[model samples]
Target: MSALGTPRPSPLPAPPPGAPTVSAPEPQEPRSRKWIVWLVLILVGGLVVWQAAVKPRMEAQAERASAVSAIKAAKVFAGTLARTVRVSGPTSSQEYTSITAPIMRGPEAGRELTLLYLVDSGKIVKKGELIAQIDAKTLEDHIDDIGDDIERAEADVRKRRAEQAIETENLTQTIRVAQAELDKAILEEKASETRTVIDRELLKLAVEEAQARLNQTKADVAHKLQAHKSELRILEITKERHVRHRDRHKTDLVKFKMYSPMDGLAVVQMTWRGGEYGVIRQGDNVTPGMLFLKVVNPAKMQVEGQVNQSESSLFRIGQKARIRLDAFPELNLAGKVHSIGALAAGGWRQSYYIRNVPVRITFTEVHNKVIPDLSAAADVTITEEENVKQLALAAVRREEGKDVVYVRKGDQFERREVKLGLSNNTHAAVLSGLEVGEEVALEKPAIQMAALR
Candidate 1:
C-alpha cells in the first residue's frame, strides 16, 4: 500500500494470462542506512571548510580594524630641543639706591627721628630733588642758639684782647717812669762828689733805693703781661670751641633735608612701628640707620626669581631667557641669567621642605611697562642641543620598571627599551634605542576579544 493511505490498484489484470506472479522483494535496511551515512558526510565536510578558511579570514579583518582605530602614531625627529626651567617672582631694578635715616652717633645714638615730610611713593624723582624732610625744627632751633653763642664768644674774645692791650701799655708806662727815677738818682749821686762825707753817704743810699724800685717795676710788668696773655689764650680757645659746635650743627641741619641721589622711582620701605609692620610715611618715627625708602632705576630692570633645588643645577649664568610680566602679559621681553645664588635658600614664603636658589635675570631690551616689584615669570633655556633625536613625551611609556616605547614595523608594533636624557614638558631627548624618522605608537593598541577566542 502507498504510504499516503490510498488504496492500491487492482493486480494489473492478474499479470497477463501466463505471466508468473512474482512477489516484490522486502525493503532492505542496509540500503536505507547507507543513504543516511552519505547525508552526514556532506554536512561534516562543509563545516571543516568554513573553519579552515572563512572564519580565519573574518577574524583577521576585525583585528586590522581595531588596530587602525585604537593606535596613534608619531614620527621621531632630529632637531633642537630646549630644556628649560620656569620660575616666577617679582620684577626689580638691577640698580637701586637706598635712603636711610640720618645716624647721629655719640650721645644721640639710637635716637628715634621723626619724618616731617615724605614724597609720595611711586613718584618719579629727578637727581637732586628733595625726597624727604626729617623733623628739623629742633635742629634749627639748636643751630640758632649755637649761632648766638658763637656771636657772644666772639665779642668776649675781642673784649679780652682790648683789656690785655691796655694793661700792657700801662705796665710799660710805669716801667719807663721807674727807669727815669733811677737815672736821675744816679746823676745826682755823681754830682755830690764835692760834698762832705755825710752828704755822699745820703746820695749813695738814694741811688741804691731808686735802682731797687726800677728792678721791681720791671718784674711786675713781666708778671702782669704774662697773666694777660694767658687770659687771651683762654678766650681764644673758648671762641674756637663755639665755632666748631656751630659748624657741626650746620652740617646736621643739612642732613634733615633729604635729596634724591639719582633719578628713579621712589619706593617707601616697610618699617616695624607701634608694634606692627607698615610702610614708612609722613609723621612716622624711624630709627637711626633704618632704611626709609628706595630709589630704583626703572630703565635697568631684572626679574628676581627662585629655582627649585631639583632644577637649580640646570641654571647657569648667561643663559638666555624669556620674561613675561603677569600684570602686563602682552609685553614679552628677552633676558639672560645675570646671576645665581651661591647656595640654596628657603623657598618662597618659607617653604622649608622645598628649597630654592635665587636667580636674577636681566632684561636685554628696556620697556616702558617694566617696573620694580611687578610680578613676572621667567623661562630659562638651560640646555639646548641641536641635531639630536627626540620624541614626544606621550610616546614614552614605562613598563616592567624600564622606559619603553612601541615602535612600528610594517603592520605590527614591537615593544623596545629606550635610554632617555634631558627632557622638558613636551619632548624628551632620546639617548639610544630610537632612530630619527621612525614611527612610534603614542598609546597601546587595542586587542580584539573575538580574535582571541
Candidate 2:
C-alpha cells in the first residue's frame, strides 16, 4: 500500500539459535497411485495368461517332447543273415549204452531190486567200469539156499545108490542060497532009485519049487535094478534142477553189478519210484528192467530236438547246424542233422493236427562241458547270405500288402516301402528301400498317437 496501491511483501522470521531444523513430507501425486494400480493389474494379467495359455503350451510341448522320446528306434546294419530252422530239446548221445535194473529170476523174481551202490553222476568212466550195483544179498542168499538143496539132493543120490547096492547084494545071496537048495534037492532026487516012488516024486517037486523060486528071485532083482536106476535118475534130475537154479541166480547176481559198456560219461537216469520220478540213489528200490543209468559216449553226442511238422521239410540228413548249450553259453558246437523221424508225434493234450517231428543233430565238435540231458538249442542253417542289409523284423510293418518301415527323419518318422530278399525270424533283408546306418523306429511312434489324439 505504499506506492500505487500495491502491497509490499514482509520478511520471514529465522529459526531460534541451537534448535533442530524440522522438514515436512511432500504429498503423493494421483498419477503415482494410478501407475501402481496399473502395475498390479499387469502382474495379475500376466499370471492369468500363464495359467490359461503359456503354461498349457509349455505342458503340451513337454508332452510332445516326451512322446517323441518314447519312440524306440534302431539303426540298420549290414551283416550275414542265416535262415535257420530252430529246434530246442535236451542233449543226448547218439551212441550211448543204457544200463537198466536186471529182471530178477528164481526166488527173487517179482520184487524191486534195491540199489546198493551208485556211481557219481557225470563221472567219466572207461568201458567195463562199474556204474551201479544192486543189492545182491537176496540173490546170493537164494543161490546159497539152492546150493544147499543141490547138496542134499546129491547126498540122497549117493545114499540111494548105496542102498540099492546093498539090496542087490542081498538078492544075489538069496539067489545063491536058492540055487544051493535046488542042488541039494537034485542030489536027493538022484537017490530016488534007492527010495520009494513017493519020496522020489517029493524030491522032484522040491526041485521044481526051488527052480521057480530062483527064477522069481532073478526077475525081482531085475525089476529092483530098474527101479534103482529110475530112482537115481529122479535124484539126478532134482540135483540138476537145483544146480540150474543156482546158476541162474548167480547170473542174476552178476548182473546186479552194472558196468559201463562204453568209454564215456556215466549219467544216472531218472526212475519212477515211491510215486515220484527221480535219480536212483543208494538204497532206493527200482523195478526190474527200469533204465537206471546211461553210459553216454560223448564222442558221439547229439541233440535230440523236436521241430514243427511244417518246418520238418527244412531239415535233411547232413545239413549243418550250430548248437548252443543253455547251461554253458560259451560252448558253441558244430553239428549236422543226422536223422529225422519218418513219423510225426503229437501230444494227447494237443490238437491232432499239431504234430512235431523228432530231429537228431550229431555234434561235429566235442566239448568236455557238453553232457547228456542238458537243455540245448540247435539252429540248423537252411540258407545263408553275406553282406546283406537288414533291419529288425519288428521294424518292418505290412501295409497294403507291402513291407513298410518307419524311417526316422529328424524328429518324425517317414514311412518308406522297402524291397526284401531272404528273411529270418529276427531280421528282414532290406534290398532296396532302406540304407545302412539309417535309424528306423522299432515301434509305433508316440508322436503319431498324439497327432491322432
Highest-TM-score candidate: 2
Per-residue accuracy of model 1 over 399-437 as CA lDDT, tens digit each: 899999988887678889999997888999999999999
Error of 2 at 214 (Å): 3.4
Measured by lDDT, the strongest candidate is 2
Identify the runs in model 1 with alpha carbons over 4 angstroms from their true place: 1-79, 85-91, 104-111, 195-209, 304-316, 324-332, 340-359, 373-377, 386-389, 392-402, 406-414, 419-421, 431-453
lDDT of 2 by residue, 1-453 (tens): 432333455644777999887665544444656777789899999999999999999988777666665788889999999999888999888888888888866665779788989988888999887788888876777788888999999999999999999998998898899889889988888889988888888999999999998899889888988998999999999999999889888878878888777798888878677788787778888888888788878888888888988888888899998999988988888999999999999977999989999999989998888888999999999998999999998888888999898988865788999999999989978889988999998887754656645
Where's the lowest-lDDT run of ten residues in candidate 2? 1-10
- Give the number of colliding residue pairs in candidate 1: 0
In model 2, the clashing pairs are none
- Candidate 2, which segments miss by more than 4 Å at Cα? 1-71, 138-142, 181-211, 272-277, 329-332, 351-353, 409-414, 443-453
Q: What is the TM-score of each candidate against the true structure?
A: 0.66, 0.74
Model 1 TM-score relative to the real fold: 0.66
